[model samples]
Target: MTTQQSAIYYPAGEIEEFLPQIGRVVEIKDHELAVFRTSDGTIFAAENRNPHPKGGPLAEGIVSGYYLYDPLYDWKIDLNTGLVQAPDQGQVQMYPVKVENGQVWVAL
Candidate 1:
């Protein structure tokens, strides 16, 4: 991992290795991140821990468009903004994601 400005970027993996619409768990420093690649090939990263009271892993959540349906409680979380959609409340900590030279990089 390397720091650029205020964020530290870590290499997650090759871009093609991340299947679209699937979430992958990546450990960067002490942070466990749930990284997702949307169907359109955009990458999004968020804390692996769920925001719900009975928290669980977000890596196994279902991805539909830009929203992630919490695996256990089914809370719809926006990947971009980390906001739990209306009818639900709370936010997931989000990280910046980017790809360079076919390698996926996540910032924390």
Candidate 2:
């Protein structure tokens, strides 16, 4: 049987609160998410934990263009696709984000 998952969107914050090329950690229920706004104004969300064995927090990661570079291991993870860049092998969980009436919303 196929199970359907209904997404629940939570208000992350005001759109202006997220600076471009910066990762902001937001907690929704039991999930910790790292929300990012690219220089072009596109918003993306991903799991705040890095996939590396020694990695821990991704919210403190550096945001460059469309990818997030984990400071602990310098693991490059694509904010849009959640895939670690070449030479690295792992993926983070990505979430759907949207802006409504100037409010940033993230769905999981």
Q: lDDT tens digits, residues 1-108, model 1?
A: 767788879999899888888889888888899899999999998999999998899999989999999869979999989999989899999998889899999987
The C-alpha lDDT values of all candidates are 0.91, 0.86
Which candidate should be chosen as best, given lDDT against the real structure? 1
TM-score of each: 0.93, 0.90
Q: What is the per-residue lDDT of model 2 for residues 1-108, given as tens digits with 9 covering 90 to 100?
A: 111257678889999999998889999878999898988999999988888987698888888888888878978898879999999899999988878899988887
Residue-level error in angstroms, candidate 1, position 103: 0.6
What is candidate 2's CA lDDT for residue 96?
86
- Model 1 backbone overlap count: 0
Q: State which candidate has the highest TM-score.
A: 1
